[model samples]
Target: MAEITLVEAVNQALAREMSDNKNVLVLGEDVGIDGGVFRATAGLLDKFGDERVLDTPLSETLIGGVSIGMAAQGLIPVAEIQFMGFACSTIDQILNHAARIRNRTRGRLTCPMVLRAPFGGGIRAPEHHSESTEALFAHIPGLRVVIPSSPERAYGLLLASIRNPDPVVFLEPKRIYRLVKQEVPDNGEALPLDVCFIIRPGNDVTIVTWGAMTHDSLVAADKLAEQGISAEVIDVATLKPLDIETISVSVEKTGRCVIVHEAPLSGGWGAEISARLAEHNLFNLLAPIKRVTGYDTVMPLFRLEDQYMPSTDRIVGAVNEVLKFE
Candidate 1:
């Protein structure tokens, strides 16, 4: 076991997968030679060689289409978009073709491809580099959207995504990419997809969050504990095919809930979680579900980025507001 950052864990997963499965190939802008914009694919080219680790032109549309073609032909391609913002150009290929291949072919074919991108704010990136619009992908019918908040989860979830027999949108939260380190075994074990990870348990309030926001949620939970408020924290690892049952169980016990995310307040994945809880677990609630999230506007530039993202105080405030109801 080795203690590594989230980005390093991602590299380890890619290397292990490429080693175990010869059909597993990696391609994207600078993924091979430059080792990805964040180096999540570092040292892969030397190990897998030019044939398997490819560096394509700066065209996300081409990368998405090529990955679909390769997957259809039996190659499990792991394509990278430099940033989530750049992924917008590939929406057509991902939604119209890659995501629909299995259904269109009536199980005659499957598209086993993983699209990876660094998302969210906190590193002072310029325009088109700090997007966290995961809701857009989660809304798509056939694609799975996965986000990991820690090194261990990043390793396991990425392995699961690559091995899955369907197209997956793997969003890497770059904000916490190097924020923490944890011991991760390189045994190539894949964590189960479509499940929420209960990071902490409490009886007062359930704080549901994902991606970089999970960090803030955990911090807020600790702050609440100091103030005599017990809070459970859950990381929604897989946004699409959500594990609402886990969330429902938590809410049933705590009788209060607060959903948080770095994405905009409107139409974010948090809304979906709130809706499911209201539909299936309304009677179990002790307070109205609250949301602590970014504004319903574009992610501000570096100077004002922190203001736009939800803070630990904001999460605690939301908890306080929900707690007041009961």
Candidate 2:
């Protein structure tokens, strides 16, 4: 295992998958010569050349549309939208076509493709550059949504997504792209989907989260210890087919739950989680599940953006509220 950044892990996964599968192809705006917006695709184009690692026009609608056609025809096409917000442009293709392709074909044709995007705020990127849109994709019947919290999980899950027969929306946490680092397996790592990682083990409260919010959740857990609360932080690697068993175990032990995310409070993934907890463990609950999430407003511009993103203070406050219920 070697210490690496999220960007490095993503590049390594792409490189290894392409080497193993001749049919694996990558395409997106600035992906080929420019190495992608975050350089996650850097050096891939040079290795695979223009045909395999393509740089398409700046039209997400066409990118998803074309990738669907390629995947249906047997090419494992991985299309990257510039950002999660830009992915909205491809909804027509994704919702009406890519997602429904295999079902529409009744198992004859498969949309075994991966839609990749860097999502969520924290690097002070421009508006529309960071959005946690995973829930939207998860709500689609035939689509799989995944968001890896660290370098190792990123590499493992990317490989899994590429190998899956169904369509996948792979969301990378943009905030920790270059900011966080960890030791990642060089190769030969196959992490299964539908599993959750207990990033930190504790007994007081369970903090469930994914993407960049996982990093903040851990920091908040550490602070909570200073205040005499032992918080368990669960880093969710897959968004769809959520590891409810793992979450239920932690929540059952802790008797309190605080969910964290960068998306707005309304209609976000947190709502789904909260509903699940209420359904599975309401009798075991010591406190009503709380959420530390973005404001119920648009992704704010630079000026007051800090107010729109989740922070350690916000997370701890939510946890404290749950703690009081105990």
Q: Estimate each model's TM-score.
A: 0.99, 0.97
The superposed Cα distance between candidate 2 and the true structure at residue 198, in angstroms, equals 1.3
lDDT of 1 by residue, 147-249 (tens): 9999999999999999999999999999999999999999999999999999999999999999999999999999999999999999999999999999999
Residue pairs clashing, model 2: none
Q: What number of clashing residue pairs does each candidate have, in the order they appear?
A: 0, 0
Against the true structure, whose lDDT is highest?
Answer: 1
Displacement of residue 216 (Cα, Å) in model 1 is: 0.6
Return the top candidate by TM-score: 1
lDDT of 2 by residue, 43-101 (tens): 99889999999999899999999999899899999899988889998988999998998
Q: In model 1, state the lDDT of residue 74.
A: 94
lDDT of 2: 0.89
